[model samples]
Target chain A: MDTIIQCENITHYYGQKMIYEHLNFEVARGKILGLLGKNGTGKTTIINILTGYLKPRAGICRIFGEAMERLSPAAKSRIGLLLEGHVQHAYFNIEQIEKFYSRFFPQWKREAYYELLKKLQVTPVQKISTMSCGQRSQVALGLLFAQDPDLLILDDFSMGLDPGYRRLFVEYLKEYITAENKTVFLTSHIIQDMELLIDDCIILDFGRILLHEPTSYILERFRRFRFDSDAPAFPANDILRNTERIGTHWETYSFASAAEVERELVKNGATVSRLSEDKLSLEDAFIGLTGKY
Target chain B: MYTSLFYKEWIKARKLLLLLLVVFAAAVAYTLLTTIKQFHANPVAFWEFIVENNSIRTGYMRYLPLGAGILLAIVQLTPEMHNRRLKLTLHLPLDESKILCSMSGFGLALLSGLFILSGTALLLGLRIYFCPEIVYSDFIASLPWWMGGFTAYLLTVWICLEPVWKQRIFNAIPALCCISLFYTKALPGAYVPLLPWLTVLMTAGFFFPFYSAIRFKHGVQ
Candidate 1:
């Protein structure tokens, strides 16, 4: 695979608290990779480091085979970035902002930008600050598509958007990325959106990566099992994650097959009843892997 | 590309720029009227006041440039800092230092234009009513005050660009102290001795905002 972004043993800290240690990940070309974590899991920190806004405490991140902090203007032109709030030059009207950004990119597609804006209820003279969050999102996305970069790093692109707008954003982005064969690295608080968008995912636990696999891999193998048991305690190992018992109910999530989970439950010395295997959506799998606490 | 950058700054600052121009024109007009009224009321008394008190009729407008500088910096830079929107600018497909230099250059050019227009108006008005000696001296005395305007503008950029709040406070202290230098001397030619040094100071101060921009880009806090 051709790697577009490579982070090796990256470590960072905010004050004395270690956000992550020796974290490593890679984004291959033409893949949409999602970075998911709970609050304070350093999703934004990684984005900052990758974009050269924040220096890592240790290790290095390279994009297009150059150090991120020192990316040449030519290299920078190949990447599109959308900040967490979909921030743009708010003072500029729609046409003006497009004009402003078009000057920087050699291959800017004016029609690509205006095409997306055409879907919104915005005028050419409307300043971005006056637009709603949904409108601002379209503006930001429009600018990104116009840039037509080879790689796009979007930080929480779905933030502050209503569900309809979020779906619109994902659909537009999915179509664009598919048509252009672009590499994308993104994070979003809305995991359901990620289910429809990302090809690969890296689920971040506290200070470590819990899993990094293709979306299909996780969906195919990771399962949630539930049963009724009088046992007050349940045993957990590497295969079983976050085993919980409430009243006569027992539930756990694992990548093991149904027979393997049944054997493990039987060996745990609990009388299992009503054992059943359920497939998980991305959001449920995410919660199951990370736990509910 | 730099034109586009300039266009962006122009859009953000044009309203305040027009308002500052009007404020400057008003100051010059008010000074011209005051000088004409006082000289007509009592020529000999006005001469005595000019010679003994060393007070140019334009003294009331002394702080105008400084005020203009402060207001211009606020309007030009405050929005960029709002919600940390400077990231959008820095992320442009240009060298970070070049981007910052282009931005500060645009602001400095605008300040220069405002100062030159107002200064020339005051000089012409002074020449109409006073001797060449008084006009020249008055113009010379006003140079440092105008320098204060550019200094305040650049220093304000430095403060606003600083990413850390505590560092911004630290920057403000020295900035205020430096601007205070231009307001200390009262006489027409008093600042001539300090002009070269002030020029050097202003030239060096041009880079202070770039330094703050670097720190901000590095996520210093």
Candidate 2:
């Protein structure tokens, strides 16, 4: 598989606060990659860097195998960017906005855009500002689809959507990309919605990437072992790469077998109760890795 | 692509441009109506009055251009900056500077065109009452005001695109100083020494907003 998006040793700081440090990742062509993190973990910052809206203090981000900071307009044309909060020219009506963008892209697909937007029951002449957030997202999405870009980068696609709208968004995107040889990199706080959508995922925490791998690999191997005690010792090791401990409840992240986890926990002086094994959801793994802190 | 870029900006700017033109026309109409009355009452007195005491009308008319400049820039860029619509604009498949230039250039072109049209109207409308010399006096005196619109646009662009609020105040100082140079009251031909300087400053001021744009593009805030 060819690499479509690549970031190397990215270091960024918002004033004195470090957003990311020596962070590295990549997206394969035709792969659906999800950037998962809690608030202030620098997911949006990474997106901005990839789109060349921001320049990092150190390191380079490349899209279409070109340096993103200096990505030419030709390179940019291959990328479709959906700004956070589904932003667009609120001044233009649906038709006017579409007309405005039609001239920019050589592969502008007007029918494909209008067909998707028509489902929202919005008239072509309605101003984007006058529409609800969900409707505006549809407009943004329609424009992206119409642009026929090779890479679609959606920043917080589920920021303000109701579950129904989010489901529709995912279903439409899921159905669309399955047939096209396109790359997708999206960030979202709604992990459950993304669980069914992303093939590969990265979880970011405290300015560092905790995990970046296939979602199925993570789901299949990574297990959260919970230990309950009056005073449970915090499990820390190479085995437990990330841990979440709260009051009397403690959980440790490990890709090791159940017996290995039991041995580690027993040595750590935590009384294992039932030692139940449950398939971890993407959200669970994210929380286990990132923690409540 | 450039045509559509201009059209997009034209759509945002046309209403304000039209309104500014209308307001200017009304002012010119008033001046013409009063000029005709003065000419009818006493032609000699009317010519004497303009040549000797014309600073009053010129000062008032000059502000028209300045105000148009300020208003046009505010209407076109303020909301876009506040909502960060410039982000969407910069993401287009064109050189960032080129896009920024087109956005500001569209407003400049249309606003300049409107001011020129207003100047022409004043010249033709004043012709019914005044001689060629008198019409020239009025028209030439109002030139700075027309140019003031461009200055206002530039200043506002500087201030609007400056991402940081503290830095915007710093930018406004120089912009305001640049605009104040045009407001010095003088007769029809008195600006001969000042016009070239103002034009230079206006030409140079073209890059002020782009400074803010480059800073914004770099995430300088």
Q: Candidate 1 on B140-165: residue-level lDDT in tens?
A: 87888899988888899999989898
Interface RMSD of each: 1.0, 1.2
Off by over 4 Å in 2: A228-232, A241-250, A268-273, B42-44, B53-58
Model 2, A9-41: lDDT tens digits are: 999999999998999998999999999988999
**DockQ for each model:** 0.76, 0.74
Which pairs in model 2 have colliding backbones? none
Task: Supply the DockQ value of model 2.
Answer: 0.74
- TM-scores, all models, native as reference: 0.97, 0.95
Instruction: Label model 2 with its docking quality class.
Output: medium
lDDT of 2 by residue, B1-221 (tens): 98988877877787887788789889878867766676788878766867686532534466788888888888888767866788888888899889988888988887878777877887887776557876676666767777777988888988999888899999888888889888776556688678888898888878989889878877887
The TM-score, computed over Cα atoms with residue i paired to residue i, of candidate 1 is 0.97
Model 2 chain A: which ten-residue window has the lowest total lDDT?
Answer: A227-236
Worst 10 residues of 1 chain A by lDDT: A229-238
